[model samples]
Target: MAKITAAEVNKLRKSTGAGMMDCKNALVEADGDFDKAVEILRKKGQKVAAKRADRESSEGAVIAKVNDSNAKGVIVSLNCETDFVAKNEKFVELANDIAELALNCNSKEELLDAELNGLKVSEKLIEQTGVIGEKIEIGDFRTLEAPFVGSYIHAGNKIATLVGLSAQVEGAETAAKDVAMQAAAMNPVALDEAGVDQETIDKEIEIAKDQLRAEGKPEEMLENIAKGKLKRFFKDNTLVNQDFIKDSKQSVAQYVKSVNKDLTIVGFERVALS
Candidate 1:
C-alpha cells in the first residue's frame, strides 16, 4: 500500500471540504493518489447522501445570493427533517451552493437538474440526505434578474423575498430590499389593488356579507359594511396597500412614491412556511 502523507490529507481536505478523517481515509483507500482520493470521497459521499433519501426534511435554511456587481440574485429553500441537521454547516453550505446555482437557472425544474460542483442537484440532495440522515429536498427555488435586484431573508429560514426595481436610485438597493422584507412580512397576494381579480374581490365581499348577516346586522347597512370589509381585505392582501414595514404611517405604495416616482416595482417573489 502506498503511504499517505499529512500534506496529501490536508490538500484533499482543502479541495473537498471533507473532514480530516474522511480525507485521510480516502487518501489511504486511493493508495495516496490525490485525484483518485478525491474521486473516491465524492463517490462515497454521494452514496452516503443517497442512503437517507426517504427521511423527511421538514426544517432547513433559505439561502440567497447576488452577483458581485449586484445585477442579479436568487433565493432557495433547502429543507431537512430536523432543525439540528438544518443548522449543520454542511447543510448551510449546500443551501448557499444551490442558491448560487439558481442564479443561472431560469426555472425550478432547470435548477433541480443543474449540476452542483459536478453533481446534479438531485444527486447532491440525495447524497446530503444520506449524510444528514434526513429526507432533504429542495422546497422552493426563485431567481430575480434585472438591471438591479435585491433580496432579504427574514428571521431564521422561515421567509425569503426578492424584488426587482425598474429604475436605480441612491438607496435603491435598500428600498428594493425593504420591499422584499414587506412581502415577507405582509404575505401580499398581488402587487397592487388593481392586480386583485374581480372574482376574488367579489367572493371576499360575499363572504364578508354572509358573516355580517350571521351577526344580525341590519339589511340596509349590509352594503356599507361589505365595502368597509373589502377595504380591509385589500389592506391585507395587496402589496401596495400594505403598511410599509420601516414606517407604518404610510402604505407601501405611498412609501415607494415618496422615494421616486419613476421607480416601479417590476416584480417580486416571496416564499414562506406553507
Candidate 2:
C-alpha cells in the first residue's frame, strides 16, 4: 500500500471540507489520488445519507433572505436529525447559504440543484450529513415577490416570515417588517378572506354547521349561524382581520394603514422548523 503524505491529505480536506482524519483515510484508500479521494468521500457521504434516510429531520433552522432591491425574498428551513446539530454553527451557516441561493432560484428544486462550491446543494447536504453524522435535508422552501419585500427571522432561527407590500414608500419597510412579525406570531391562514381557499372555507363552514347541529340549534337558523361563524373565522385567521401584534387595539389592516394609507400586504410566507 502507498503511503499518503500530509500535503495530499490537506489538499483532499480543503477540496472536500472533510475532517483531517477522514481526508487522510480517503487518501490512503485511494492510493494518494486526489480525484479518487474526493469520489471516496462522496460515496461515504452517500452511504451515510442512505443509512439515515428514515431518520426524522424535524430539528433545524429557518432562514430568510431578501434580494438587493428588497422586491423579492425567500424563507427556507434546513432540517437535521437532532437539535444539537441544528444549533451547530456550520449547520446554521449552511442553511443561510441555501437561503441566499433561494434568492436566485425560481423553485425549491432549483435551489436544491444549485451548486455550492463545486457540489450541488443536495450533494452538499448529503456531505454535511456525513460530517455531522446525522440526517440533514431541506425541509421547506417558500418565496415572495412584490413592489417591496421585508423578511424577519425570529430568535433561535425557528421561525421566518416574509412580507410584500403593494408599493415602496417611506414607511413601507417598517410596515413590511411589522407585517412579517405579525405573520410569525399569528400564523394567518391567508392574506385576507378573499385569499382563503374555497375548500378551506367550505370545510370551516361545514364544521361550524356540524357543531351547531350537535348543539341542537334550530335547523332553520343553522345556515345563518354557520355564516356568522365563517365571518368570525376570517376575522381570527386572516392577516388583514387579525389584531396587530404590536398594538392589539387595531387590526393588522388598520395598523398597516397607520404606517401608510397606500401600503398593503400583497403577499406573505411563514416557515417554521420544529
What local distance difference test score does each model get?
Answer: 0.80, 0.90
TM-scores for all predictions = 0.82, 0.93
lDDT of 1 by residue, 44-138 (tens): 76676566656666688987777876678888899877888777887788888888888888888898899987778876776555344467788
Clashing pairs in 2: none
For model 1, which pairs clash? 49-126, 49-127, 49-130, 55-135, 57-80, 57-81, 58-80, 58-81
Q: For model 1, what is the C-alpha lDDT against the true structure?
A: 0.80
Predicted candidate 1, C-alpha RMSD: 3.1
**What is the TM-score (0 to 1) of candidate 1?**
0.82
lDDT of 1 at 257: 75
